[model samples]
Target: MKLRMKSLAVVMGLLVLPGCQNMEAVSPWIDVGNQVVKNAGYDTDSKLARGIKETLYTSTDRASTGLSQVGAFNLSLPSAARPVADGLRQFGLGSYVDQLQDAMNRGAEQAVAEAAPVFKQAITGMTVNDALGIVRGSDTAATDYFRRQTEAALRLRYQPIVEENLRKTGFYEQYKGLLAAYEKLPVAGKPELDLERYVIDQSMAKLFTRIGEEETLIRKDPVARGSLLIGQVFGGAEG
Candidate 1:
């Protein structure tokens, strides 16, 4: 009996030792993940700025296609805001649309160019906890957090630019024309169209969507798998 008890104790100790070490190793990953998320969140402005730049550059290439479909010289309109290389068949803007598209693209390019460094600086100021939450949450969580935190400030900062872009792209004029037509209709309770609000909402939605895509890629792709601590705490390799 004495021998059996001693043997049992020895086996239990061995088991506990490995378990403790495993737990310790796992703890650091959580910290690392938190740090990464926080960093990502803080840098969201930069990321968004970069995304805008890419979008604009790509849009420039598709400007002609947009024009052919719209028959208008306004690109800042909702119709021409479709993603690039995705075809311009849907905007239905009619002819001269290319001019609008090009101008819109140029304005977007300018806005991003002006905003990128500001966004970068903002991101650099994010806290570690903020980063962790973003890193650990859903793919779009970080972007969402950034938007929630910075939207007000960003709007204040970018509203003038958006207005300028709208004017430059002829959206301001076209929007007024549409509003005039709408006002003449006998419609009741027509919601006022705030162009600035609409543009900001649309731009933010697209930006978040792209961030979510990146998050999905990070979660599923083998190449990006190494970026997160997958198998240890969250479950084994199978989990």
Candidate 2:
């Protein structure tokens, strides 16, 4: 009885614990948008929006190619730094993890392209305060702001697109099968991870990394700004 109770306790704790592999690590916004700019009193063609659009137009395409390639996620800092949870790795689903990781990158690759217009529209809502904040903030400052404000919005806007694309590729089936296999193991406990949320968050993170890289480059070298307005706005920062 004690042993059974202890196992239950462990599973419950794992359920509640927050980490990448743990369910909660998927982000609250997952469990948790379109009129945002109109509500902010800025139209799609607003100056802030135009600036962001231009910046993104120049960068997003290149970012897509660079980041969407095979092995991209494995090469990212996030992969190395993200904790995979002891239980997940101990289950020894190494090949499953590899395939899942590849699927995540593939899903994200398309997501970035599909999300471009949404992100561009989202830029229309950026306020002067937001501009000042991003300019004065870190390299990924704008990306951070975008995540805070639009992750939920983006999720709503982007989820269907990602779902459709992944489904067509059989990515969803593969991921579900692997996860189901894992969960069937006597010691696996209830599956704690949300593969959809994990992929979405990772997609945004990688795109943000690309954006931050561009932002940092623009800040350091005048040539990369792609426009006078962006240069004047973000050029002074040392990031």
Candidate 3:
């Protein structure tokens, strides 16, 4: 899976791209790459799935730090809601919240890990001609295409796992406790949160977002491809 970095580095300089962040501006190269992808012997779908899975690993690591770890959820809420939440969390309510969240995160991590094979298999319709569609379409087109094609299947596959994890985490009980505590305060308003749905939806959204970014990077950045198959498909275009 080692890509030709030195060659790619030389091409990157010749392409006049500023940095990895700037690759989106050179999407026209997608047109060039697409032609190569079609004629290249490797499967673009497999490469894409692997890249996305790798991206998911990196993304979920970051997300775990921000969303699944201790006090992670507390920092992300709106300012108006923070003071009351902070006061309660200062007492021991936050421990339950963090525990529930950590459970959800662990579940999501498992689901995402399980999803790599599914993602690869989901692209069953990925013909050689599809490369052109990916090139002509927007940055998120691959993600959009994949989701549009397999969203229903993905949900069916992921929901049960999410629900099971939530149960294991005691999310429902914690949510009820949190809501009751909120309702007890004379000044506290009802927070109407669907905890189960929130975890499921948020996990799916983050997974997809990471996948889309991986798709974009594979199409745009030489270094990000990280595979001989990827480089062969995309390298000859700019080489």
Write the residue-wise lDDT of candidate 2 on 1-239 in tens digits: 67655543343233222222322342231222112323444331243344444555556556656766655655221342235633456788555455555555666676666666666666766765565444335556666676676567767765775566556544577656876787677873443455666677777777778876875565555335566545433342211
| Candidate 1 local distance difference test against the native | 0.44
For residue 179, what is the lDDT in candidate 2?
A: 66
User: What are the per-residue Cα lDDT tens digits for candidate 1 across 176-238?
Assistant: 687678778898876645555555555445444544454444334312332212212122222
For model 1, the stretches where C-alpha displacement exceeds 4 angstroms are 1-98, 169-194, 221-239
Ranking by TM-score: 3, 2, 1
List, residue by residue over 1-239, the lDDT tens digit for candidate 3.
23545544443333333333434555566445433544444344444444344433343344333443333322133344457558869997987656555666666655555565555565544654554454345656667776676566756766777667667755567656776786677775655454555556666777677667766666565345534433333333333
lDDT, residue 79, model 3: 44
Q: How far is candidate 1 from the true structure (C-alpha RMSD, Å)?
A: 13.0
- Candidate 3's displacement at residue 100, Å, is 1.5
Higher-TM-score candidate of 2 and 3: 3
Q: How much lDDT does each candidate structure score?
A: 0.44, 0.53, 0.53
Model 2 misplaced regions, further than 4 Å: 1-62, 68-102, 165-192, 236-239
Give the candidate order by descending lDDT. Answer: 2, 3, 1
The candidate 3 region of ten consecutive residues with least summed lDDT is 69-78
